[model samples]
Target: MGFNMALLALRNDFKKWSFILWIVIIALSVYVFANWGAQGKIGQPTSVIASVDGDEILFKEYVE
Candidate 1:
């Protein structure tokens, strides 16, 4: 469907839309968080330290 029609449909069906919007936002958040370390690049991480292979690791995306 076209963009305007899709949004218009949602407006006419608000009850269904509330549920659908929630689900879509949740799904999108999951996808984003899952890809965060790979693609997300922003925000502030104060310490920025973690462990790997029993070794203390820093920076991001391994030492690679």
Candidate 2:
């Protein structure tokens, strides 16, 4: 039925595109595998490590 037709069409497409599709899939897999640890290397606590002002430097005191 429809499944058989789809199978036939899929086979045709595979014949036409198997090589290009394989290249694309291999490239994507390599890129993904290489960048697998990139996520863990991001979002680190990049903080301001120094301060010169006093602890009681409030906005109300500065406004007066």
Candidate 3:
């Protein structure tokens, strides 16, 4: 009975740590993604060369 109680406590602790680890992983992923594509623009207009109807065509797309 004592061994069972210890095992149960260990399992609960493992679950708690797993939850914290997942939370940390998600937060880090969000932080990285938020900053991933923010390095090039310094308050400049995007590379759009033309607009048709209401859709703007990017220069990169035109080149491709």
Candidate 4:
């Protein structure tokens, strides 16, 4: 009977640790995906539409 009780306690501990490990893994996966997704292109310009003196106007700026 004592051995059965000990086994139950060990199983509960294993479940708690497994749940925490899964949560960490999922959070890291989401972070890595989002970080990579945000970097659209390596060297693509936002595009400069015009320039005055030395300042330039970007396409994004014109749209906004």
Candidate 5:
């Protein structure tokens, strides 16, 4: 019975630590993603795909 109680306590501690680890990971992921998105690359084109009427259209513009 004593051994069982200790095992149960260890299991609970493991679960608690696992939950905290996941929370920290998710928070860091969100932080990185937010910073990346704020760079204004969402609609900007990286390369020209085609030219029509002497006007160049970007790959990003074509996709959107």
Candidate 6:
């Protein structure tokens, strides 16, 4: 009996706040997906990670 009452109260509280919950969820989803889409347009990093004096340092060579 007590457990059922607690569950009912929790359900009512969720119903009251459902709209705010949806807004928060949608806002976070939009922010995450927007950033994900932007990453593709930014392009990948160059093969040459750096340059020193007159020499260009390739990423692979730099790692070794």
Q: Output the number of the lDDT-best candidate.
A: 5
In the range 2-62, model 6's lDDT, one tens digit per residue, is 9999999999999879978999999998887678667752344447558899888777322
lDDT for predicted candidate 1 compared with the true structure: 0.73
Model 2 regions more than 4 Å off = 1-16, 38-64
lDDT of 4 by residue, 1-64 (tens): 9999999999999999999999999999888766755764333446657888988866642211
Model 5 TM-score, 2 decimals: 0.63
How do all models score by TM-score? Answer: 0.39, 0.35, 0.59, 0.60, 0.63, 0.40
What's the TM for model 3? 0.59
User: Residue 30 deviation, candidate 5, in Å?
Assistant: 0.4
- Candidate with top TM-score is 5
The parts of candidate 4 lying over 4 Å away from their true place are 41-64
lDDT of 3 by residue, 2-27 (tens): 99999999999999999999999999
Off by over 4 Å in 1: 1-12, 38-64
The residue ranges of model 3 lying beyond 4 angstroms of the native Cα positions read 40-64
Give candidate 6 misplaced runs (Cα > 4 Å): 1-13, 41-64
Q: Which ten residues in a row have the lowest lDDT in candidate 1?
A: 37-46
Report how far residue 33 has shifted in candidate 4, in Å: 0.4
Put down candidate 2 lDDT per residue, 1-64, tens digits, no spaces: 9999999999998987988898999999778755754654333333344444754432321110
Give the per-residue lDDT digits (tens) of candidate 5, residues 1-64.
Answer: 9999999999999999999999999999888767766876455556757989998876645222
Local distance difference test, per candidate?
A: 0.73, 0.64, 0.74, 0.75, 0.79, 0.74
* Weakest lDDT window of 10 consecutive positions for candidate 5: 55-64
CA RMSD (A), model 1 = 11.7
Clashing residue pairs found in predicted model 1: none
Rank ordering of all candidates by lDDT, starting from the highest: 5, 4, 6, 3, 1, 2
State the lDDT at 36 in candidate 3: 54
Clashing pairs for predicted structure model 2, backbone only: none
Cα-based lDDT at residue 28, candidate 1: 97
